[model samples]
Target: MEDPIFSPPLHRQRHQFVIDFIKRNKPQKVLDLGCSECTLLKQLRFHREMELLVGLDIDGATLKKKMHGLAPMSTDYLQPSDDQLRIELYQGSVTQRDARLRGFDLVTSIELIEHLTLADVERFSEVVFGYMAPVAVIVSTPNFEFNILFPGKTGFRHYDHKFEWSRAEFKSWALKVCLDYGYEVEFTGVGEPPPGQQESVGFCSQIGVFHRLGGRAVCNMMFCDDAEDEFSYTLLYSKNYPSLHDNNILQRVLVTEVLSGAEKLRRKWAEETNGERDAADTQAEGDWEERHRASEQHLEMEEKQTDVFLLVEIPSSEVEISVNQMDCKTLQQAEQQRGFWRSIRKLRKKICFGLMAEDNRSLGKCVSVPLAVLWSGCPKVRALGGSLSNLRQLLMDHPGVTLSQDGSAVLLNDQEHEEEYDDLEDSGYAEARQCSHSVEPEEDWDANV
Candidate 1:
């Protein structure tokens, strides 16, 4: 079922031409003119620059059967995206004028123009070049000039092809379309000619790249659903992919980033202050001292200056961003910092020395986290296996924490601090627990300390 002359198959080569075109011109909104089984649309979905990807085919049933592959993947939740993308499949003819198909950044028709009759081909030219007038258009069809290179091929390459055009004939029609529609055209082809046949034949498949002049195509058809009678396209599938712009995703990014940062900071602070003490604790020093000195006797008599740190865990509920809590510029920077897909590696620390630092500061024994900063932009708050909100509410319901009178901040009485944080004695928290060997996402703060 494959031709040796083309080497890599003409259809695949055709698709590659369009894919390269997309890479060169990162069009926000793109429409596939004759999307048969949506093979090209499936490949185009991976491009993050593609904001709106629409596939149009006359066969609704075939499209419905094939579009399942275009749905969001399960792995998307493990990793969230900031790119705004929407994919849609609609059943329609390129010959007919559909208001929804107007003003696209690019329009593509691969090996499809040959499938239409001579009359429909004229209509296709008018609808695509004159009516739907995208910024750029790519059309590929069989090059009749290359037929001589085929061994046993007699008629057109495919039975569905109405009339295959020679290189000259194809160029004549493309140049006429540009002249009639105020656009410029460039001719190119894929599937290199076999050895020693380059002079006679051009290529297995020919392509035309059309660019519209006079700036961008302006259309008033976005909301023009008034004439329902003329609309030929039937909506098949539509989905708004989860993006970082969403409050839920934003909260997740913020929560994960802050938690991860806080954990690293706490680890560094602990390592610097109690690196030797941590080794002692791991060597049964804590348990040994507890048994030997009866716990409080040794801590109060010799090791007393070191105090336990405080980390106020936020709620699990998706944070609704507020101006007081964080600004848009901060959120953008946070998103840019990760530069990775999904929360593969996060801090997720439930106990840190005051998680956020903004206008709020630690007062005395109580370390305060601004309620605003706590619910910072796109902060997805989770702790260990359990939720941060559940444990936070649990602590609040109990005598574990206290709130400021104005409710602007959450003052955690759990964190017992001295007048100064720097030059503090060996960390009591590190001395008691040692290094974070048992760092779990769902561990409760009360039990952790």
Candidate 2:
């Protein structure tokens, strides 16, 4: 399907529900089944970390036609002119594509099965279930009751649809398939009838989630109904976390701890058992401790494997900032700090920190003045992050500060020069004057102030 300004009702509502599901549980891979023309695929903008999107359709020609219309994946010489929608669009019927479909974390069959023949339906169940990674599968089909209102209008059915069921009939069939196939079915999109429609035409859609014995749980479902009547429906299916205790990292951790503790108890029991053992079980006790110790150690390592840490780095600068504290002469760290603050003087974001002086003698002394203010009339801070002309404008804003001829130092309020920062120049026998460390506290140094 071409990217339409407005998505059909069923597809649009279904997309909203899927977006919400992704927000809560971000899956790494998504399989779109019977993805005709992939209209919704165009609108999806995943976070940079997302990987593995597969769009499957029964017709290779249709798939290529649609993908080419959108734009192909780009290489160095041939760039796609459209948005970088590098989806993996596979050509082949889902029933025939089992060899290509095995690892997806989510399999979404949206309003798809109704079009399949009964044989195709069974093949779909077997193939889709087999392809999933011991996880989950989502199946959605139109509600037959919904089809009643549009009788003979043929909405859910393409001229190709073989069968469509009403709400109860569909749910009954879902309940049977789930029970027989070990899937847990959930009904959705059913609600009060739209104001003036028949039960079949106005009734909402439904979805089901199937968990294979050894696969990850399925998490997405899309159901799209009629577009012309404005009564279409869409539904998304998201599974709650599954319980595979053997697969849970934390559970494995705790199990290892318990087994290690059990091994120790086993050793104590073995010693007791040995006192009464005959030759028959003597060899078992002889090697049991070593074996248990090794197993326990293995579990301990497994427990350690459960710990996860994530590190992310971005551009930032770290610098110390201080503020004068006159009331208490003792130097103290400020209790609060701003993560980001804008410096209008520099026209850039500045990382800020505040410290309260603790020494009574240093009370009322200016804490290290903010670089923004200290270099206010000078262009030093501003020029570092922007052009010289912009820096001159910034200097013009602050009246008293000035820069020396070489522009390496800043004169704060004309009292101190940037060269004053060079401690190495005065190292050889120059007695540094001790500025008065003693000063009275200013009245308003409290954090609230």
Error of 2 at 326 (Å): 67
Which segments of candidate 1 are over 4 A away from where they belong? 1-3, 217-230, 276-449
C-alpha lDDT of all candidate models, in order: 0.65, 0.44
lDDT of 2 by residue, 121-227 (tens): 87777666633332556666766565444435555546777887766777776677666655666666533345776433544456666555433423122112232
Regions of candidate 2 where Cα sits further than 4 Å from its true position: 1-8, 45-49, 69-86, 151-156, 190-192, 195-202, 211-449
- What does the lDDT come to for candidate 2? 0.44
Backbone clashes, candidate 2: 31
lDDT of 1: 0.65
lDDT of residue 21 for candidate 1? 86
Clashes of each: 15, 31
N/CA/C clash count, model 1:
15
